[model samples]
Target: MSDSNTTVFTNPSSFILLGIPGLEVAHIWISIPFCAMYAIAVLGNFTILLIVRMETSLHAPMYYFLCRLAVIDLVLSTVTLPKMLSIFWFNSREIDFSACFTQLYFIHCFTVIETGILVALAFDRYVAICNPLRYSTILTNRVVAKIGMAVLLRGSLLTLPRPFLETRWPYCRTNVIAHTYCEHIAVVKLACADIRFSSYYGLLVIFLVTGPDVSFITFSYIQILRAIFSLPTKDARLKTFGTCGSHLCVILAFYIPALFSIFTHQYGHNVPLHFHVITANMYLLLPPMLNPIIYGVRTKQIRDRLLHLLTHKGT
Candidate 1:
């Protein structure tokens, strides 16, 4: 163990990720479900992209947003899963210093992008249902392109500071991280220098992303509900509600685990370290795995097109 005075500002060339602290014995067993989730997420997200790409009838603001989401989910899962599996399956726990920060950047970057996309999707649904006549006029291809650009730009700019901030800290305490992957907070905690700024900045990033996005999504849904209830008949109301249900489910799937993980990591004093690790991984995995399935089952066009593709692929 190196002391703070001697090792201050001496960055290690590489860091050892402990996979899951206290669960080394069960790493192999834990990997089984993680592998399954990764496989399903990859296949499902790729299938979603392929289906959206090939179907001209599916060309609309909603489907376009869904494609953006599929791409985000694909990249998000790809960023963390393989490395995690390597640690678990092959015992490859060492990650280069720069590589760890890179992983940290992409993981948080795409997560913020996904949140923005979800908000955009909610706005799309709000326009489609609440202002049907203006839907085409409002969310044109140009407008959608701009929205996509904004989401990417915001996510990139916000998360770009994370690696820089983390790298500034002197890792004199240890190079062993208790988590499976290079999570920003976990990596920052190893620093011997004052980490208060890093911690506050992390909270700031979370607040800036979640504060406005959640408020907007909630406002959109509230208006959507008002529009839904004012429908002249029961069937009309049901139809509108059903249309928004899948997006609602996806939003819940994304936010619930994510918020839980964040809160537990920050404040859950009694929570086991293993539980934090598992929840962190789950927040990343569950949304990507469930998003496509929820959309496929809930959206009639996607369901029919997916079924058609599967059935005809054999012939």
Candidate 2:
């Protein structure tokens, strides 16, 4: 273990993140709202998961993907919010190097997995909309299960290297992380050794995991749009668009902030550290909160079922 006295300023064992300016003072003010958001996010996604599991009508491929999405949202939220809430309520902001890397690993892993699942979902929509006749045969339970497995495996493999690389570096100096949650790049920046290899590997993983997935999703949507436009009835087109609108909203909610965060981290780090911290929280917290709402409000079936489920318990 490296001691603080011997460590260079740049190669400290840990960093002291300044956190959001005034966050310490605002902790009380923000805790209630943050807790509310966390509760809503968990409950909303859990409700969707439960509904999908219990409702026989939702046994189709679409709902299967939705259930998987709910699981992802639950996990994504759990990984970040609990820690953040702890910090706010208890003022326990300190994290060790190993724990930080562990958190970073899962955060990146789940983020990539969700992206892959979204791609799979886009393809599912394309098949359902563009080739409705063969949809059932093409996206059967077995195939969906396989795709789910693949998504998990790919995400795990891609993100595994990040933590491994981080562990190999010696931490001799700072320990304070600026953000509430442990982020992979931020953790990497604290390493005492050279991180050129880590950065290169990170770039490669990003391209391999997210780049192609987004491209495939875009392609699937393009094909879906083409097929929708070719339909004879306007009602059919409108219905199809409506079905996909929720998913598109979710995809945008998840990816746009991610892309913006990437851009800012790469180019805008000089702007203001607080700006980056806010964006990081937005990236981590917003998707899980928004996903259930997008699906619930957009899909009448889900909305009606949720309502029934909520109301029927009292009777």
Point to the candidate with the largest TM-score: 1
TM-score of each: 0.95, 0.92
Error of 1 at 230 (Å): 0.6
Candidate 1 residue-wise lDDT at 315 = 81
Tell me the tens digit of each residue's lDDT in model 1 across 1-315.
234224444588888888988899999999999999999899988888889889999999999999999999999899899999999999998899999999889888999999999999999999999999999999999999999999999999998876887787678777778899997778887887788877678789978999999999999999999999999999999988999999999999999998899799779989999999999999999999999999989999999999898889878
Cα lDDT tens digits, model 2, 1-315, are 234334455434444434464457886776677678778889889889888888889898888888888888888888778878777777766666566777788888888889988988898899989888999899999999999999999999988976886787776546656677787666666667888888899889977977798889989999999998998999989988888999899999998999898899889956777678778888877888889989989988889998998799868
N/CA/C clash count, model 2: 13
Instruction: State model 2's lDDT.
Output: 0.81
Cα displacement (angstroms), candidate 2, residue 14, comes to: 7.7
List candidate 2 segments past 4 Å from native.
1-18
